[model samples]
Target: MPLDTNRLEPVLPWLKFRGPDDRGIWSDRHIQLGHTRLAILDLSPLGHQPMSFQDGRYWITFNGEIYNYLELRAELVQAGYQFTSKSDTEVLLAAYAHWGTGCLEKLRGMFAFAIWDRKINQLFLARDRFGEKPLYYWIDQGTFYFASELKALLALLPHTPELDPIAVDLYFHYQYVPEPLTPLQGVRKLPAAHFMTLQLDSWKVDLSQYWSLAQIQPLEGNISELIRAELERAIDLSLRSDVPVGIALSGGLDSGTIVALAAPKYKKVLHAFSVGYPGSPPCDEREQARSLANQLGLPFHDVELHTEALVEFFPELMKALDDPIADIAAYGHFAVMRLAAEQGIKVMLSGVGGDELFWGYDWMIEAHHMTQQKQRQNSISAIATTLGKLAHIPIYEKFAVTPKLPKPVRSLLVQGLNAHLIDNEHPNQFVFYNLRQDFRSPWYHRRSLYSQEFLTQLPERNPFHPSVGNDAAWSDITTHLCQVLFNTWLVSNCLALGDRTSMASSLEVRLPLLDYKLAETVIGLQKQYPNEFRNKKAWLKQAVQDILPAEILNRPKRGFEPPYASWIQALLDRYKDSVVSGSLVQSSFLNRNYLVKLFQKPYNNYALVYRVLVLDTWLQNIR
Candidate 1:
């Protein structure tokens, strides 16, 4: 049971890009902690991690910027606490020493850190409110191991971890594995807004939640003013860094809002970075971004992502992601960060959470109304509606449904076309809303695409209910849907992509809109004015209208999107062999015949094809 220093060596190599500034390891009787520091707040040796406090009663290794540390330090000082260094790491230790786990409530900005309480012989770990940072942990044969990246954790494990069947099934359905479950058997991610404690004496672990979107209640005030004030404050705090900060500018309102509010307040010349395609295709936003930068008088830098570059780096991008997520926007995210890194920018601000926080996506509202209509149906009405859909499908199929209609739209039309469909009010009903078209279909439908062997391997339970629990009230369906989006797509897909791609370049990306306080204000405002949210970012636009240019404000919303149709075809052409006889088929997780057909006409079934390719490519790369 003695601590093994050698076990920590392999992980550092895998995570060196995330924290290249410094490296340290600390160990005692049965404990060893390792850290590689990026050194954003304090670049001195005093800011090194595996940092200790109170003559070593508490030692800590932290990742992420505590933007509000200065404010917290003053409060801690008033409570008779003192610090040796100006680093947030010291303030974090002192905060924990004084407040225990209560310290999580007082801290702001993104973070994932652990405190080793030598006095109690206990170890404590916590992730930020929105999971802006990553933490993966595994337990085996009485040993607990954790790291910032899954590959790092894999290197530290005693043996090779097997692919988790349930995780694979969920990944196929959701395009990414939801939290508390990773792709490997026996390995899990710590959920966001949560903390854990492990006592060395008994080796017992306790996990608890510190925050939830559901905890926010409706606020009463000038809603626009409240939101504007919170946003400015959040951006102001985000700009508090010793290193140079840049903005991930885009053509849309979200990034424009950040630039409008942040450029003036930034202490030095604020740089703007953007990514576009070679042809200046309609999807490219570089021109808009360049115009904005010119108007603001900020230096602008942009990169063109040729298809060849994306194809060449596809495998490395998959590996850098560390988790097999099928999102195509990752290429853009990686390019922008790499551009920023090249400019010597250590930290960047992004506008990621706007769509999820406000009612930005119009389809979200449609999904909410559709669920309500289904809930209000009586058996007779349900039967009539089901039959109407069935009757129209043949007629619509003959004339309307083309071979290239995109499988998602087809799946959406055919979803819930089975018996006992009236009882679809379960949280699983919202799966289609989040782009998981075939997740909750009847067994007959699943059997067509997934192999019987794979179907049998899956447990007889709803995969989504674990993450999207049915505890929230269905009456407030919109809020419930928003919460589900946050828990599922927003965290696993959007935030995960941001953290992984940015950190791959060893740069820190901060999302001011995702600040917990700003999120709470928006959610609370939604509760008070539910009708206002249905109008799609009405309050958000109003709050930032004065600062945002009218053209930028009114421009349609298309976030850092790539030309998916072309990119997917290019990826398919490059990795088609994987789909024809790849990991999913060879392992009997997907039916070979179905996969062959899907691959034959990739356009029709691009979603499923993309997921299969990503998984197969990932399995191959890791091996």
Candidate 2:
């Protein structure tokens, strides 16, 4: 029997969610596509999507917001495009009809949408420049499947997808699987700034690049002035919500910048949400966030997280996540979204793309320093000698500098040092190691699992090529960061977590920072601009200077990391049987003894622990 649309009903249970009170899944046979709405703009019946447009000539299931819709609508109206709705979706349809694929260039936002063009008998699929929104698809026997979440696609597909063991290895090294590959082998993520048009008759999917971050160019202006103008524009574009809009304010620079830019424009005290834990050092950014909120005169809410909350929410988190991502930050996001829904905020803005766009990550600095240092070496032999010494130090201790070395000397010594930072364990191997450690008496033997020939042949069998090659050190920061951000963090964690958590509450979250125009412009910048991003978003800080407080401007970028290590240790002590004795250890997927060793060591491997706990909880629930 052909797979009925009715059978796809249980695939996306969260799409039927309305407000906070009623959140669950539903199925429909008549509708070919299902949507899990975030409700970012025009929070009316008119704005509801998987929406029919232009006298039902076209229907769209869109996952992201178009920030410049109002401006585009004004242009369309002038060009004789009348509207039945005040939705960006309608505006997008009109733009598509008028300009075809060219419409993508005229619009600015982070988005992924599937448009059914009735006249053309085709399906149009697209993802934004930096891939802030995810679009995953699986094509089999002339039937094409797609969804904002990979799990949704998996739910609809007839066959159980095979695990990509190589991807499992990549996940261990990168913490998230790089794009174009999912945990499942058959499913694939659409690349950033690209689109595909599927012809129904022939069942052909033609992919093309609508935009590229490589096209960004350094603009000639005062560095601070340029930063201010572009950032303000980006914020203004993101603030295009028709429903009540709010910010996920953090002590970090990016979210602070967003709050500062948006607060003055908001009529009432803007509702800001944050998350933390009681008495956790790394988790407490509440005081700084509170200070900024006070300065801006916004109503701020901080939810103190508890271990029980994490345990209770673990299964839901796993279900929302398509793959077993090791990034523990997803839990923090899940907590925040729960709080956001409780406050009745339909759409919340996040500063997710700031680090990728503005060279905000320490990796960028380290990569740059490493590249420069390698250049200064007299010979390849000399460079090899330095790497040999660094390799002698334990991988875990690599980040720490000798205490006797002066700060400047230490910086110089570490500058331009490039090596594979993760302990040489491959991703699948690491998973196996972690699992084995969890099961046995917390003791495991290490062994070289794969032969050199086996390792060499792995990539050949893989569907998606690794974004950064084995030999590629981070020589080019701009391109490298763009690839890493899009392929790894944005796809694997940020958008994935946001989609799951927000949809669980029937809320939509929008990211303006990942807008195509903004991303392209930032990526195009000269490598030497704004003094090498030494301050990490130094230019962005200058751009929003007038709007942001001086104190906030100078603050370091503390990313959205909760105190998972401390919480996990506490959880382990209290619920040792639940975690350690669970199926996670028994499964052949991870090395359980290594996990025990990780826990035994007095270090912060909170992310690793959380991964095990989440997997443990998930396995327990499913079993």
Candidate 3:
């Protein structure tokens, strides 16, 4: 696959951040394959990508490490496949040559790659199971384009891509565009666990799902032991890298668990990086991260975040993200990744997926509690509705036994009054509703800040329409809601931020908790013993109880976010005019008057302020 001088011109900017080593391009009239090497594995010319097999039947331009390459290479070796170099790229090519699409099921680790099957004149694209990596594609006027970043794919186009209105709608709803939808129209995400095949001549497309997290069921064994074994195995496999690997350590249970497990097998100093804010509240995890690092005999590295730094680097943060994500926490990840890269570390494992897998979010508990109260209220409401229809009584007349209840429960009941019959509503739907309304700050609360035209144009989209499965929990609704949050919130928003920010520094961030095997184990444990899924990450806590100190395990949930209040205030103090008078407001995507009011008033919700400012910064930098 020689570099086409024409295509190369537009793609050079993308190569600047990633391809520090030799760049390889394999191009012909029919197809073009390009790669920028980071040289993590088999750091030699042989590891150069756009790699092909001896017969040149399959060619791949891949990003990410195959931690199981050695094991896969061993199996391929016995099957009589010869390798020219000890590169995962070669193992990947050989495995594909032998097993075809079946090879994906046998591999582990984060990856997004395009394989050109010259034998069939087709292109096959696949992403890892948990979307630890992102692959975006656009189909335009008979041409198919895909890239690791939207900016990379945009480089190949002539004119600027328009902002997708629906995506902008979702960005305001969830602070990020939900997957299968990018900010640009015509572009779509290659969702995790899915694959696509394109016929070269006809340009016909076929997409398929190769794996499903819903395949989980109750396992017949001690739940804690099973989780411990599965997770330890994932860590073992993830730590198999040629270059030094580091840990994105924090005070939380997840990263602490990874460090405890990998400390023995890492075979190096086990460098850990943490982010802190200068003179801020006790939110920063520097001291806690340092304590854990000391207990584990690992070296600790950290960077202190300053408000001015976040304000000045605002646009670069959006550029690093390649898309707008309203999460202020991404800044923390960016700092740690930068620190790791500066120390010459290429690979790092993060503890990101545990919450999604083992039900670690605060909303999970809150949703369950709300659901219990709703069950009691609905029981009374259902009887009243029946009486109202039979006796011409008002629906609320008798139901007004009017017991005083908590505000959260009363608010949900009021919202559900005019709602359609939810008699058959799945537990997951209820969970999704409770979480979305309770956890998410929808724009209806800030409708005054939106233009009337924008309000009318806002599509009535339910972001939680995707299924996470509806069985095995006490009710189908419970687990279904959990899975929705896992996919929509964790994988798409959280993991997307992790990939973009880390890759912006040419650093690879791995998640052992997202290991399909480990995820399956947690889901199975919940299904098998539904009653025991009571505590947040309870199984996880028990699994590593012997390794993690009690203090670390008992610490309250401090999520992966720096002190954003002061940071947003600092940013607003410097750029309030720039945002209030910026394109986002002037274009009517936001209300100029409301923004000015927000700036002038003593706004308490600094997070909401940060989100809009981030949006404005992105709108400006994108051009």
Candidate 4:
């Protein structure tokens, strides 16, 4: 029943890169804690983890930065609290000492930390609002386990845990395991903006949320000015690091906005890093990135990846991302972080949350418009809408569109009819309005990829609902859509990919746009002016128009994507055997014959095949 120091051995090496500066362990009668230090602030022996305060009544092991630590520290000092070291870790402990769980609302940066309070004989855990940091925990035989990465958590288990079929189902449907669920049975990721407390005396665990984006009240101001001021302030706070910081630049507005504001304010020269392909494909944005870097008088660096390099890093990339994200663009993130690490830049800034917050995705916009039309239709008009679709039905082929409408538009119209008129489901949900005949739609609706046994294993739960109560008061449909994007795609895919890929090299990536305050402001702005989003990020463009280059402001949103055709074909050629006899088939979760047929025509089934291949490699690596 006593705490065991020996158990830490298995998970230590897996956590080495995440915190390579130092290692520390602490234990008492009931709980054991371990931490490996990255040492971003107060880089001295005083900054050691499992740090004690108030005569060892409170012991803490922490990860991530508190950008507003100085301000919080000054306020606590006024309240008769003192600190020995200038690290954010100490300030965090003091903040808890002063405010208890309410302290999470006061902190304004990314974090996932646990504090042991001997007075109450309890352990407390919390993650950041937007989930820029990672936290995973499991409980077995009355003992609780937690770590920043899934593999590290897996390493500490008594045995290799059973594969969670529900998690696997979500992965194939959503492309990543949604939080509060992992691929291993009995393990969970603490949902973001929430906290957990464990009481040893009674063995009781309680979880509660402290923040919700859907509930923020609208702020009053000229929307553009409010956004610009808050964005500038967020970037300024994110620059409060002792280590050298740089920006991951690209040809798009999101990264460009970061480079424009952050480069000038960063005390030292803020370098920009990017990734490109060998032949300068359309997806490559190195030239645009270099041009912006030149205009700003900042040094620019980029890595060129060939199909061979991508194929080589494919397995390693899956290992880097603890969850199977099914995103081929992950290599671009990993490549940029690796390049920055090589240049001795420990901290890098990324532009991850901008697109989701600003309605940048054309699909999201179209969904909103389609829903708006549905809301306005009466019974007769609804019938007329069906008739109109029928009028154009003859001209369109099976899953093909005419030349008059753009491809995206035609797809939207067809799916809109199916969702409302034909299928008669999901009248108000955009998450179900998928763009492709692939994994983008929910698992319940898909039939081609999943086997009958796997389908039977899935629970009758709506995966598209936000983890937070769906009935919470949202200002408008746009707000509802944004919240869904935040919960599903933004947290699960974009932020997860950014955090893991960057942390693979022990580098910290800060997304200033994801600052909770900025998020609340944007949510409020959306409520105050719902029509502004019809123009796709018009408020954001106006906010940074003067600071950014004219060309950068008006450019299209070609995100950091790969040359999919060549890359997928090459990857299929190299890792084909994985699907034929890999973990998916070995576990009886996939139909092997169906996968084999799909594998033969890689180009047609690229997205679904890419997902399955990643899952195969990930399962092998995990085992």
Candidate 5:
């Protein structure tokens, strides 16, 4: 059966890729719609997605790289599987024909693909472990609609799902609504490392997990040597692309390491890109990146984002994002990728997964101490109450009283002091447990939004099990840090932002650090090499010590920081009447007073500005 022309047209408009220039969707009239993509690998027309195999018994629309395709292709070749072209797409189809659902277990890369097994009369959708790629689906009126982006799925449905206010609340708190829930009520993001198979006739979906980080065996070897070997292997695999590839270098350890690894592998000098605002504290690292690039004998391109450029790109940037996220750094990422795209770099590597792979965040250490201190006695609440009386003293003064304690003990004392300050803070009288404080929307006050039953059920659904035992600091690295990185930072900041920003520029960005096998291997040996993650990627630094320069190796982790607040201020000042008087804040969904307060106090409030700006832009365009 040929695909329906009408249904295919709608999917074409949603495509963000530009390489090879084939954009079309395939819909089997009443049954299915398949979208074809042209990624970095397999540039031939035969390698295009929606590839049919087994005499048209199977069809697949795949996204992402399969690093182990060569190995899988070898095994399938021996199993009498013939290929038309050197493509992972054909390899995937043939592998699925031979192994069925078991083929998902054999895949070792970041991917989100949908395979319609015509013989089985079922459609299978799967996402990579750690959700490095995205797959969104919505069911409506006995019809199944799926896409790499929620907007495409929405386009297929007859009507959009009502805005999920609870999800909005979660967005303000976590900057992103975690899996199983989306901004729209009826849509859902497929969980990572899991697959969903739907019966065509009945339209019934069954989901199952194919892989888990918890299942990996702890590697017993010299930790530094193992890290070096695994990281090199992963980097080499990710660099397999026909088009010219570049690295998104932040003078940080992760990107620096990537540049050092990739520079020697490619035939020509690798192009490196970075983004920053002039005179900004975060922008100080651009010189360091340039110096490293010079030493590596590569061309360094710095995308200097001004307030004017940010304002110019703000509206489109908002529309490019899948959801209204408060990740301010995303602006800088998008700008750099846009510049990279203009420079004709099709594929680029990012330092996204490094922080999560290693215990590189302050919160990871803080959470470890908090989990341990809670066990000493549930005295946090009492200590917080006592510290409330010392509100007259500065926070450092309060901390001074608790000096001479162990590292963990000191962390707990700091936590207690901070909690006390929040509990007894001045002005708004709002108490905040999390760093984010903009979740005080009127919608949050609704009984249905935060039901007691939902709260009670949340503990069970908590991704990291409390009983997993965080007795050792290494447990923090393996469990809490890994969970936070995967479930929060990587999902929200790295992958989500990377996909949107890169795709917005029609560039494919890859993360070797987020490799599933590499993550699993690192997590398993976390406890064995406790000191490695202590100073955040200490082991990774040691492993690449020889390859990377001393300056690059010892450089502090400065994340991609965009000048959103400054940009917003400038925009508001320049186009104050248009923005404020426009439908953005005037919409009933958001409070005008709160929006005004946001502009009044924009320091460290880039999230607030981003959320409001994106929401405003979305509302203006969509409504």
Candidate 6:
């Protein structure tokens, strides 16, 4: 078997940002395999990939670092296996040689790889447990196409893919396209923690999960301490790299804890990178982020963003993300990764998974904790308003005349006292509800007018029933909330954002929190010790209290974001041309004239309007 250089030719342009260091292609009559190297570990000729085993029984073209490869390699050596290179690629090939698909369990790191078993004449493809890395594939006419990025797949495959209507509808509701469904037709994301074994003879596609977060084997005693130990072990494993590694530090507890733990394990001085916004209070985390980095004795890197800069980068950023995401914070993450790349760093650690796994989100945790007292108060308020009671006059006036109140008062009334009346209005509310309830017209204003076709078909499908962890029981609303947030928000949006942004600069971003072992432990602990988590991220705060100063460790969640609300007017004004000229609005499903009005509407509607802008820009760019 060999690689066809011609098939390799089309993906080179797409690979420029993914692997810029070295290029190689192997070709023969039956097969073509190509790899562009981003040399993190074993920066030598021997580490070159599409790497093959000694007996030529297995070959793999892999993306992502396997942190525990050294341990695996040592075990294989004891089993009398020989290696030619120090790269994890060789170790993975040996693991497959020794344990077969069992290798998936023993491996730890973010990855998406295809291993060709020469003896069996089959190709095995696998993605890491939580989807920290991405794999897209398209199969047509007996030939299979796969790539680390969707852009590469589109470039290499002959299919002129059309956008899937269902995916487009999901994109509007969820803000990012969900898994197993890419924005395009004929291409799909390989669901995480799963692998597919493919063969040419029968053309059978056998997809199976090797792991799940919900699978419970009761581990007794002090799960928090065990979780802490597992998290520390994951950090140790993630530090396995030949290149300089850094942290995407923020003032928040998650990244702060990561830096505190990782600094002690790393030998040389570690670096931390953070992004700040000029006028934005929440985005300006430099003051506190730098303070934590100083205490940890790590070198710190920082960049400041402004509205003008975000405006300029909008179109390019949308184009880079193969599908559009309504996450404004994604640009902030991209900026920090680009900062790392400019400094010649190849790998960085991030704190994305801590929220979903450990109950860091306040609204999500409070969804079940809402008091009977609070619900009664809300109902009383509603009835009073309906009957024109004098006591409810102030509330009725506030609700009826939503125009004149200052920003702060309106926010309090809508988010706090009026929450149950509104069902779910906050972004965090979307974490608990299914797609239909989550996308209700009152909150997501555009939900009422989605293309008639999608609206007709939407009720037949449930977006929350993800393929990976659907077996997890949802009878306990708390457990259901955690799974929903983890699957949809953590995996599809946050993790995907980190992967694309970091890889765009040829850097690897590792999230120790996403390690399958850690996730399973957290889920187990959530089941047994659900009471301890009543307070937001209390379990995690206790775990790291010894390592970090209380001042830094106890800080409430501060999002790393530019002032999206303040900058929304400018952002929309800048992209108005893109919206009017964009195909999504031009189509019968959506009115361009109506979309223009939404974008040009009054203040305080930034979140909804920017989502429209993101979708419009992405549709135009992908076309």
Highest lDDT scorer: 1
What TM-score, over all chains together, does every model reach?
0.93, 0.81, 0.89, 0.92, 0.85, 0.87
Better of 2 and 6 by TM-score: 6
Write the residue-wise lDDT of candidate 5 on 96-187 in tens digits.
Answer: 88998899888878788888877768888899887877888887666677888777777777776766655655655566676767877788
Runs in model 3 lying further than 4 Å from the true structure: 1-5, 368-428, 433-440, 445-447, 461-475
Q: Please provide, for model 6 over 1-623, each residue's C-alpha lDDT reduced to its tens digit, 9 standing for 90 to 100.
A: 25455878768778878888887776534566778889988999998877888666777889888999999999999999998889998998889888989999999887899988767678899998888888999887778888887778878766558767778777766778878788788899899889999986678899999876556554556866987999899999989889989999887888988899999999977899998877547558898889989988888999888878888998888877766778888888899999998987888998888878777766565554542222234244453333333212334434633767676655544443334432322212322433233333213344444555445655454333232223234234455566567667787889888888888888989998888777777767767766654457777888888998888766778758667776678887777777765777565446555565666657445655677788778777766
Whole-model lDDT values for every prediction: 0.82, 0.64, 0.76, 0.81, 0.68, 0.74
Candidate 2 similarity to native, TM-score: 0.81
- Scored against the true structure, residue 243 in model 5 reaches a CA lDDT of 80
lDDT of 2: 0.64
**Which runs of model 5 end up more than 4 angstroms from their true locations?**
1-5, 16-20, 279-282, 378-477, 529-533, 563-565, 572-588, 601-606
Q: Using alpha carbons, what is the TM-score of model 5?
A: 0.85
Native-vs-model 6 lDDT?
0.74
Worst 10 residues of 2 by lDDT: 428-437
**Model 1 — TM-score against the truth?**
0.93
Model 4, span 1-623: residue lDDT tens: 77777788767789988999999888787888899999888889899998988889999989899999999999999999989999999999999999999999899999999999999999999999878788999986788999998888988887878889888877777778877788889988998889999998998999998987667887778888898888999999999888889899887899999888988898897989999988798889999999999988899999998899889889889999988889888988999999999999999998899888887888777766654554554343455456435533423423435667787767666654444331223433343334333444334224555678877887786543322213342226777767767777888899999999988999999999898889899888777766554456777899999988888898898878888778889999989877777888888888888778878853576776788898889889988
Candidate 1 collision pairs: none
lDDT of 3 at 171: 73
TM-score of 4: 0.92
User: Model 2, 591: alpha-carbon shift in Å?
Assistant: 4.8
**Candidate 4 Cα RMSD after full superposition onto the native fold (Å):** 3.5
**Model 2: residue 329 alpha-carbon error in angstroms:** 2.9
Q: Candidate 4 — what's its lDDT?
A: 0.81
- State the weakest 10-residue window (summed lDDT) of model 4: 466-475
